[model samples]
Target: MASVCINEALTDDELRSVLSKLEEERDKEMFGLVCKRWLRLQSTERKRLAARAGPHMLQKMASRFSRLLELDLSQSVSRSFYPGVTDSDLSVVADGFKSLRVLLLQNCKGISDRGLVSIGRGLPSLQSLDISYCRKLTDKGLSAVAEGCQDLRSLHMSGCRFVTDGVLKALSKNCANLEELVLQGCSNITDHGLADLVSGCRRIQHLDLNKCNNVGDDGISKVSQACSYSLKKLKLLDCYKVGDQSILSLAKFCKNLETLIIGGCRDISNDSVISLAIACRNSLKNLRMDWCLNISDSSLSHIFSECRNLEGLDVGCCEEITDAAFQGLGSMETKLPLKFLKISNCPKITVTGLGLLLGKCDSLEYIDVRSCLHVTKLACDEAGLQFPECCKVNFTGSLNEPDLL
Candidate 1:
């Protein structure tokens, strides 16, 4: 009689227990190859997968991985042959992965309102969703999602141009627990929509309104007032309509703001910048005020003196910023925590100012002085020798003559 194999005698539960002990994917694959039963068990235990979108492939995945919790069907620009995921593919995902928690469908051009409806009805347990650049989706689809997925904490809908105030209203009504919302390039959003959203979702911590031209001081002030304590990071890049009143409101109410980007907000002046620096001195860590031409040495002086915890700063292209700004920074008695600095394209800055900054900031790790008319490549090369071994300086366009070597 043939000897009985110990592996064959083990029950399904014991096999599963052995599989759970293997940490590496290679080890798990080897275990599955030992027998047909192990292979079947491995397929059922799989939890996350990222694959090209197709109806037939999705069907096969659903049948094989019944407990999959995360699915990524985002398409790459180089792979244009695959016409992108459609509503039918989403229907299959909704029907099969009822316990799904995270779904990413970025750049799925073929998906529209119909696909989102299927997701809303089926995936009530979802906590995060990224449909960024899915331009075909509008208020109708996202409203359905807000109504169904009340557990949602993060939502990214960047470049969904068709979305307007209506979706914000819907989300405000249902998704009160939302913490991160990225609406970059949704140009149709206005002050009223923002006020409504912030009133309901007071827990929002990170909000990005980059390129939402219609948003101005009124909307931003409302956000600062409602989500004052909870807000930590905000990006208003290229929101030209935003001016001093918005920043002033942030300084007064949002004391916990850690990161702020107001680049291209040309109307911002030294007064508001100084106010913000004083108010958020202890908490502010990163600040970018590039192209805010109205700010000058006074704002930089206050920032250097007050924001003791500041680690990163960018005032690039502020034409009015001159050597005086660095003079104040150099005069500081206390060692600065600043690690990154960018003064690129400021025509008034020269090697004298750069030297002053380098002398004081021993903690510097990265510096960008590119396009400063008076700064030379020769000077930058000498400065590189003095910087710490880890420091890197970008003087890309400073070379006016050929190197001697």
Candidate 2:
């Protein structure tokens, strides 16, 4: 490849094409500073903007990037954190970018229904909206979004505490094209709300209901019935009431299911897990059963044998898993070698058993065996030494050092 000169003169379209390929923020800024033409082209070409310096900065940038299509005003709690964007800024952003398609306002805690109303009325072309962790948002704010952005395909409202069944009803009626929804930690939502949402939004494929404690087996069963054919990725982390019955229902209908995370669903047993693995065997790729105490080696045996395309497996904190559990993976033949495995807190998994498992997984890249007392730091180091330098072995929880025996 020949080195390209930054000073090379190109048409506006050519500049836009070259600038779009630059992924790094610094590179984009440098490209803008290349020349007057480059600067103008870069400013007009920018469609996606993520600003953490609050809404005022975003407002200033909006003037220059008139073609802005996606805007992210999300906040973080890091050391560099500053005052968050408010309704005033959101209104400004909405006024500036009428063609905006995606907006991520996660953790902008100061926003209320008034700002959302403005956003809904202003950004009518919005297709994807992520307001997750914005605790101040209520049903009123959400209703405003549903009414304004009826063409929305993806919505992430996780950690919005005040949201309830009313919001789901509003979304179901308005956002019929909705394909992906993430309501993780929205404890106020129950079976009725979930059932209502799924019933209306039959196109929903990706759903994240993590920590939604109020939703039980009935709610999940309703989801399985309504969006089973379209649903592909489902996460139910710490959903205390969800158990084997929900899995069984999903297995029967969700034939195209690919990724499932039921971490902390302690009520899940071997039979239900095995049945699910068998049902979605061809499509299932990632399975995480962390803290599902009832599952043991038996479930792993069935999963490894049936789920041939399994690429990632996490059985962390599954106390019932012993050295015998890995025997299944070691014996099975897989087209795609398991790349990532997490067996953290599995006390019964010894160094010998882990080594055997590692030997079988030719493409294994990362393995976390933290808190496994039988697997010492020395063993982990030795395991890493055997594999190509690219592989990483984690044995952090154990304190025992190597002894010169």
Superposed by TM-score, candidate 1 places the C-alpha of residue 306 at a distance from the truth, in angstroms, of: 2.3
Model 2 ranges off by over 4 Å? 1-41, 52-60, 79-83, 329-336, 379-388, 397-405
Cα lDDT of candidate 2 equals 0.84
Per-model TM values vs. the true structure: 0.91, 0.86
Question: On residues 1-405, what C-alpha lDDT tens digit does candidate 1 reach at each position?
Answer: 999986779888898898899999999888878777778889888888898757788888888888888999988867645558899999999888887889999888889999999999999999899999888999999999999899889999999999999988988999999999999999999999999998799999999999999999999999999999999999999999999999999999999999999999999999999999999999999998999999899999889889999988999899998888878776678878888888889999888888877777788877777889888678766666376566767789543422110
- Highest TM-score model number: 1
